[model samples]
Target chain A: MLAFIIRRLAQSVLVMLFVALIAFIVFRYVGDPITAMVGVETRLEDQEIMRERLGLNDPVIVQFLRFIGNAMRGEFGISYRLQQPVTELILSRLPATLELAFASATIALVFGLVLGVYTALRPRSFGSAIIMAASLVGVSLPTFLIGIALIYIFAVELGWFPSFGRGQVVDLGSWRTGLLTESGIRSIILPAITLSLFQLTLIMRLVRAEMLEVLRTEYIRFAKARGLTQRAINFGHALKNTLVPVITITGLQLGSVIAFAIVTETVFQWPGVGSLFIVSVQVVDVPVMAAYLMFIALVFVLINLIVDILYYVVDPRLRVDGGGAGK
Target chain B: MTEPLLSVRNLAVEFPTRHGILTAVQDISFDIMPGEVLGMVGESGAGKSMTGAAIIGLIEPPGRIARGEIWLRDQRIDNLPPEKMRKIRGRHIGMIFQDPLTSLNPLYRISDQLIETIRTHLPVSRDEARKRAVKLLDDVGIPDASRRIDDYPHQFSGGMRQRVVIALALCAGPELVIADEPTTALDVSVQAQIIEVMKELCAEHGAAIMLVTHDMGVIAEAADRVAVMYAGRLAEIGPVRDVIKDARHPYSQGLMGAIPRLGESLERLVHIPGSMPRLNAVPPGCPFNPRCPKVFDKCRTHRPATSEIEPGRRAACWLYPGVTEA
Candidate 1:
């Protein structure tokens, strides 16, 4: 088991390397960063000097190697638009995106598991039918469209929440105090709901089907025949057996969430790695963009590793060498 | 005579199909007395499992008891609500499936499953449950019961898993244990060991068993009385020795001749030639009519009512119409 886990850990390192290589190429080779930095209004002469200054005139390999070197040393150069160290700007904005992602994921998991099992338990019931219908519609709607619809309903029309921002750093003081305050929490509600809908629907559908299939298996039938309550059978036996698949799906979706979160951040105007990524891309701040890209990639690999570990914990069949020839 | 532990009277089960309603079990009736092992022998698709599921009220949606009276200890249990039936199941009437591995929850430890059954019916502390679980596992012949109780179902061998399943069913000390082909999935050698374990354990607990299987050899060895089901109806029922040595129903005879034995000639094993009738298209009178070698015009258009043959034997066939119980 230990050897298998160690091997899996090595595989995770490989994934990070792949992500880093792709990110580096995308940041360096695609389009001129200096043109974006100089803007359409800047003179060609000034642009040349800026290009030379930033070492954009160098070969792609030389530029990438230097970028990788500086990145490893925590020097993300400077933010072109923010006029600050790329690391400082990234660190400041990172909290908002992470907070949003965490909140959304929590919402998705709670609703998904609950509604999923509930529907599986009573698929033909009116309440379960309604939840199934709602989830289908929820899954069909695009994330951007959901965001816009949410902004209108909760922020504009309902007047229940703030449409944008993690709230001013000046107004709320520290991140600790900010979350505790009424305004900060209220601001996060709309964006969090919008982000969770698609993910929640996907999880609920998957969980419902997986749970139904498990319950039909002999083990579940025996559990029932043993006079275990319906609740015990559904939650204890059926749900636990279905979790490995759910975990894998959740990890993969979360990786996608970190990628597509930019659209949500853009809509909500919330400051996180997502909006940081967008601003860096638009202003051609390759250093900050690289920092954000690496962070997301690192998160993806870490989540996958966590999923594999959890799966082994759940099923000994997943444990290599734990069950010799039991495979 | 003491009131039987389980009395299933005129039970019928049906389900909605695309064409129309289909009856799975039609007016089936049987009784199980405490400490008596009743083997229900049948071909595949004989509605044997469905009958057991109906008795426990685990029949899910799209399938329901059309009309029935399931009497357990003077209580008419068929119409009882789901919660009530669920309580009765694994408590008064325990069940084991054909597959031992699948009969246990993959996520739970053996001890947890055993204790869960106990706690559901009777109030018991976790420590008490654990203590009882170890004893129950020991009773079922699981090795290292004291130490291995914490292991999951996947950790145990197939026969051992079936033992655990039996232990689970017997944990609540149920009056009636319905084993739906409990040893069907085990190896030939292991099958005998598991069945031996189950019979001994059940006898020790004074539990009546409704053992469903197609194997007459198993029925001959384990059962006191035997029931033969063909299609959706009971074809014959009597003492096990009578059913095996002198079966009243032709279908039962066919089943007996079906299995190959050493010293038997290379002649074709007698099989009821035609495919078993589908639920919706069962014959008007006798379910086994089409396959019966002595089938008559009356057998085709009119169903024959079950008639008593001897003191304890009853058969649903026209041949037994004039036989008087003496």
Candidate 2:
């Protein structure tokens, strides 16, 4: 097990390096940071000195190494547009994004599991039919559209929530959160639901398909024959087996939620790092963009590592060293 | 006679599809007396396993007990509420399935699966259940039961896993165990051992077993009585030795004839002509008529009802002197 974990960690490091390489390429090939930083009125000598100080004149390999090293220490140079240290800017906004991602994920997982199991257990029931039909909308609609529709309904039409912005954030040390206050919680409800809808449907469909398949397995039939309560058979045996695949999908989806929540963040004017990335892109803030790329890649690598371990933990068959021996 | 532990009266299982209703088992009746080993033998799709599933109330959806009744002792179990039937399942009529590798939950340890079943049916404490689970495993011939019980299902060899499955079925001391081809998926070398373990364990617990398989050799070795089903109908049922040595029904005779004898130098084994009819295509009269060499004029016109061939034997064939039309 220790070897397995070490192997996985090594893989994660390789993956992070690969992603860092991509970020480096983006930093190298994209519009010049100096051009984005200074106006046309800046003197040529000043630009040359600035480029030398930033080590743009170094060998490509040296510059790439410096980029990786700076990324490791969470030190991305000042954003070309914002003129603030990219790391501090991202860190300040990290809490909001993390909060939104977590809330949406919880909603997605809980509702997804419940609805999936429900629909699977009663595939012919009216409620299940309705849920199955409604899930199509969640699946087909774009995230921005869902966010806008939710804003129009709950925020514009009903006036129950604010149409835009993180409301009434509270600080826990250096971390700021909108989760503590009433307005803050209400403010998150729309964007969270919008962000969660697509994932919720995807997870629901996955769980339902998997749950149905698990129910057909011989073990479930044996469990029924063993006279276990329906609840135990459905949840304990079938659902537990179903979760093996669901965990992998859920983990990947969670990484996507954190990394690609850009559309929902933009639609609701969410003050998360996604919107910050968008603004940085508009102004060609290369440092912030590269940092964002590296951060998202790190999130994916960490999540994939955690998911692989979880898969091993949940499935005992995977743990056995040798293939199954027939009697 | 001592009361039959289980009774099925005119049981018929049906599956309603878009095409039509398919009768998987039709008008079958049988009794399993206390501690008896009754082997149900048939060709593939002959409804042997379907009968077992029906008795346990596990006929999968779209298929159900469309007619008749199943009784465990005096309780009419065929129509009981699902919850009530669930209580009776592990507590009264346990089941072992075809494949051992799939029968046990892969995620759970043997001890957890065994203890859970024990606790589900009996009001024993967790420790007590664990102890019984270990004892059950030991009884089924697993070495180091106490330690092995902690291992997951995949860790054990297939035969050993089947032993675990047998232990599970008998854990709650169910009065009747339905073993649906329990050894079919096992290695041929381990087949006899599994059968022996199942028979011995069921006998030790005084649990009547309905062994469903097409393997006549298994029936000859482990079953006290043998039931022959053809195309969803009972062809013959009698003492195992009597059925194997002197099968009364034509289908049973052909079935027995097909099994090669150790010393016989026959040029070719006897085989019945034509396959068992599909559920939707079974003829109006006797289902076996088209395949039976004994097919006669009367066999084509009407269905024959089950009738006594002797005091303790029955055959649903018109050749039986006392049989009548349904």
Candidate 3:
């Protein structure tokens, strides 16, 4: 297991390096960061001085190598627009984004599992049909549209939740944001629901499909023949078997959730890395943009690594050393 | 005579498809007395397995018991609510399927599966159930049962897994076990071993068994009485020796003749002329009429009801209409 984890970590590092290189090339070609920073009216000589100072005057390969060397030491160059270290800028927004991601994930997982299992158990019922139709709407409709609709219903008309922005956040020492606070939680409710809508439906559909398949398996019939209660057979035998695939999809979806959060954050004006990413992109802040790309890529790789480890933990078939011994 | 442990009265299982309702098992009836092993032998798709499934209350959906009744010791079980039926399943009657690999849950240990079954039906604590599970494994001929109890289903060989499945079926000490082609998926060499284990264990537990298979040899060795099904109906049912030696139904005769015998240099094995009919297009009268050599005008127009051919023996054929005495 240790060897497997170490091997995965090595692969993750290689993946991150590849992502960094791609981001560097893509950002460089997209636009001139110097022009975006200084505006169109800046003098040509002033732009030249600014370019030379930021190492844009160096060869592409030399500039990339220099960026790599600095990145290796945890030094992402200062953001041209913000005049702060790119790492510091991302770090400052990390807690807010983390809180949002965690909240949305919890909501998605809890509701998805419950609804998925319920619908699967009573597949022919009217309630299941209604839930399935709702989930389809959740999957098909755009997240931004859902965010706006939520704001209109709960914030604008109902006056239940704040329409925009993170309500007053309390810094609970060492970069932790206390979501336990009433304002912090209430502020995030609309955004979190908006962010997780798609993922919740995806998870629900995946779990339902998997459960239906597993419930038909011969072992489940055997479990039924064993006179296990309906609850025991559905939850204990059928649900456990469904989880391996569900967990795999859930992990992959989590990465997409973080990636897609940019839209929800923009709609709600939540001060998170996603909003920072949008701001940095508009100004062409190459350092912050590249670092953001690399960070998200690293997150994806790490999430995949964790999923692999989880597979080993959940499925004994994968844990056995030499294959073909067990069926 | 003592009341039969299980009684099926004109059971008919039907499946509703896009075309119409197709009958899988049509008006079939049988009885299993306590401690008796009744072997149900038939060609593939002849509804032998469906009979067992219906008896166990596990006929898959889109298919259901369309007619008649199933009684377990006077309790009418054919139309019981699912919850009530579930309580009787592993407690009063256990089921073993063809593939041992698919019968046991791969994620669970053999002991856990066995103990769970035992505890579900019996008022035993976990520790007590665990002990009984280990003993069941030992009884089913697993070596070092106590140690192997913790092993998952995949860890065992195909034959060993079938044995574990048999042990699982017997865990709750059920009075009747519906073993649907239990040894069909096993190797020929190990088939006898499994049959031996099942017969010995069933005898010890005094459990009635409905052993469904197509193998005549297995029926000869393990069954006291044999039921011959042909195309969704019972063609013949009698003592194993009677059915094997003097089959009254022409279909059973053809089945017995098809079995290759030992030390007899026959020119060739007998082959039945036609295959069993599909459910969608089964003949209006007797299902076996098209395949039987002796099929006549009456056979093509009227379905034969099961009638006594001799003492303790019955067959569904027009030829035996007047044979009331043994």
Docking outcome class, model 1: medium
lDDT of 3 by residue, A203-295 (tens): 999899999999999999988987899988998989999999999889988887787789999999999999999998787788888888888
What value does the lDDT take at residue A172 in candidate 2? 97
Q: Write the per-residue lDDT of candidate 1 for residues A1-327, one digit (tens) a residue.
A: 688779988998778667667777877776777765665889989988888888888888797778777767777678767779987787777667777887888898999988998899888899998999898889888888999988898888988888888764433443432365578788778888888888999999999999889978878878877878888888788889888699899887877676678889999998777888887777677767777778777788888888888888888665645632231
Score residue B314 of candidate 3 by CA lDDT: 85
Clashing pairs in 2: none
Strongest candidate by lDDT: 2
Q: In every candidate, what fraction of the native interface contacts is reproduced? A: 0.64, 0.72, 0.65
Real interface contacts reproduced by model 3, as a fraction: 0.65
Q: In model 2, where do residues sit more than 4 Å from their true spots? A: A321-327
Q: Which stretches of candidate 3 lie over 4 Å from their true place?
A: A27-29, A39-52, A57-62, A176-178, A321-327, B264-268, B323-326
Q: In model 1, state the lDDT of residue A93.
A: 71
Off by over 4 Å in 1: A34-65, A168-177, A319-327, B323-326
> Rank order by lDDT, top first?
2, 3, 1
Measured against the true two-chain complex, the DockQ scores of the candidates, in the order shown, are 0.52, 0.58, 0.56
Could you list the CA RMSD of all candidates, in the order they appear? Answer: 3.0, 1.8, 2.5
Per-model B-chain TM-score:
0.96, 0.99, 0.97
Sort order, TM-score high to low: 2, 3, 1
